[model samples]
Target: MGGLAWLTPRKRSATARSVLAGEAAAEAARKTEHEHESEFPTPGDTRAAAFFDLDNTVMQGAALFHFGRGLYKRRFFRTRDLTRFAWQQACFRIAGSENPEHMEDVRSSALSIVKGHRVAELMRIGEEIYDEYMADRIWPGTRALAQAHLDAGQKVWLVTAAPVETATIIARRLGLTGALGTVAESVDGVYTGRLVGEPLHGPAKAEAVRALAAAEDLDLDRCAAYSDSANDIPMLSLVGYPYAINPDNRLRVHARENGWRLRDYRTGRKAARVGIPAAAGVGAVAGGTVALVALQRRRR
Candidate 1:
């Protein structure tokens, strides 16, 4: 019996070696095919550009919410406090009050909850959640818009404040060129809950877009930018064509004041109606909800 056991390991080792050789050969073939495909660009390429926001613009809700929920389920956060934290976020979204105190509270709480956790574990959890929930949560209209840009031979970039790793995964899934997002700092494979650079939010989003534009040689005046919040004003203004999709109260006001075109694809209809003025410079009030227009400048 001992002799048989020793022989079994040698047999298994031989089988493993054979399998690895086959895998390596297959991988090399796949790489060759991929390289060939990348060598050729499709004909009739008109170099236009488009920028999309992550939350509410491309997705139905904030990615952070789901990530937080996943962390809570993993016992990283107190189960009882999770609900309260979610409620606060909801309030912040609705009010657009920009309460630094509340923002810090949420940030610190989330950090405290996730402290000492390995980055790999969080990433694994995020991946599982993304496949099951995050991917499906994409807004239909947003997807269509992104596809249109790709079809038009335009470059599409996703500008977000989410972690770069998470954003990059989504971009790859969508077949986008790349993404610009906040990068979380890591030390020894563990998260520090601190950003490596500036958070890609508000004006910072615009900065990232500018950097991409310069790197890709994109014409900002000919590029299109889309967002749902007034906080995105810096980014939206940077592009020649600015679009406000399902905007919040502040953004609705800014859109109308700026004469930007409005679109609501949530109902699957191309927005065709100009919003009536609610307050000067603000969008028309509709059903107690604000509807702002998007702006696009014709290519001259």
Candidate 2:
């Protein structure tokens, strides 16, 4: 009986030692895994960046237009206001209007509509609107451009004047590295209808790109910038490769004067829009149709 009692203490000590050893091994393995993860860089960690503007640069029209339409449908904005907004935007498009007073009025009016809405509510609405309108509205050529950058192992970012929540949703869905956009401020969960930072447009867009480049250690000299508007001239000038995708008249003139490459993705050819051969257009249409069908099937 005494021997059995003496052996019991040794057995318990051995069991305790085994458990302690197992725990130590597990902790060591966890630490090793964490270190490995830290060693590998994510898509956003690249030293090269491809900055893309959201409106006519990536899609055919302004993202704000679609967002406003969605808001109108949801009763968050009045139909009459939406109509007026659309008309004003159309005029801006046609005339290349950069009147400060007109721009400020539009911005103020848009912000006033969501003055008291909760951030969570607005975010919910954004998600719903994204699924309904924004997702399918991605321009045919924009996704291909983004994918090409990804393939080249470059970090692709969406820079826009659209609200951050809305832009982030689209960026994430497209597997972009990151996004920078205007931020609407909230106080105690409700919106105050003011921006947290400068509105990401014109020179503001260039500033955001600079800040992002510095933070991510991206080399501006090796980066690319794409936009369709003359307002993006500052942003385009900041990068090594400035591409005008479906450029407006002003931007097209600037691009031509600077000998920058002009691409018309809408026509799906490497040639200028004015001189595109009929055969090339036919080939582009056929190829685009096949690619789109393949994309739809892949999504399904």
Candidate 3:
């Protein structure tokens, strides 16, 4: 009876009517199955999304390294461990996070050190660390770009390999939609010293976005994505509008080859290096914790 109500009298023969109704039902069932498989709504969502990679893409540098410094200052780990972390962060700065080995090492060390730490205490530390080390490091231009997406009513998400707690704080501070990061397994509200899965990077990052899209009914074809490193190419490729921010050599070449938009915030380094004042020094934190912790090795 769904579409059969529009039948003309001449075409309403009992046999024809049954066949027409069956065809209509079959089409409807096919559509519903497709929607379920793709996780798309029947009419599809009108809202779009913008996914931003953290670290060099949004902030100026490696975020976890900064948090490591806060933990080190609190005596969370030994001076030797901090030194090792600092060296890894140095590589991240110079090599543009192309080394999955360094990333996994940092992820392992960070999670391991947090074992047995109370979740509430870490959250508090995260808040304090951001205010002191991360708040000012955010690039004004990139921040405004995020705001533009928010203004347009698009969901703005931060995708990073850092812990979910850390990512949530950053997104909240910037009024972003939310964030997806590596999850550290916990029991009884304390760290278990292990990851629930692999760190979100490369193809893993794209998978995470697709999972989010399915959960939120987002349309990737209408979405936009931004990142600064070549390592994030998989993630950028997942969307229709892909922008390369402060892209490295590999990323620049790739972007150009694909005709992707590029934004270079590195020029701000000039004003930052001019010895202007506090305002200009904000750029320091881009490499702040990552660089300083290397020199801080002798503290112990």
Clashes of each: 7, 0, 0
Query: What residue runs in model 2 are displaced by over 4 Å at the alpha carbon?
Result: 1-45, 92-103, 267-300
Quality of model 2 by C-alpha lDDT: 0.65
Answer with 2 or 3, whichever has the higher lDDT. Answer: 3
User: Model-by-model lDDT, in order?
Assistant: 0.61, 0.65, 0.70
TM-score on alpha carbons, each prediction: 0.69, 0.73, 0.74
Among all candidates shown, the one with the greatest TM-score: 3
The prediction achieving the highest lDDT against the true structure is 3
Model 3: lDDT of residue 167? 80
The TM-score measured for candidate 1 stands at 0.69
User: Residue by residue across 1-300, what tens digits does model 1's lDDT show?
Assistant: 343365578675544433333233223223332454353232223346778888777776666666677777777767667886787668655653334455545655655665667878876777876776588877665676666566556666677766655665566567665566665556898878765444566656776776666645668887788887788898899987787876666777798899885555443221222243322212213311221112122432
Which model, 1 or 3, shows the larger lDDT?
3
Give me the displacement of residue 276 in model 2, in angstroms. Answer: 8.1
Query: Using alpha carbons, what is the TM-score of model 2?
Result: 0.73
As for lDDT, the candidate ahead, 1 or 2, is 2
Model 1 ranges off by over 4 Å: 1-47, 92-104, 266-300
Residue 32 lDDT, candidate 3, scale 0-100: 31
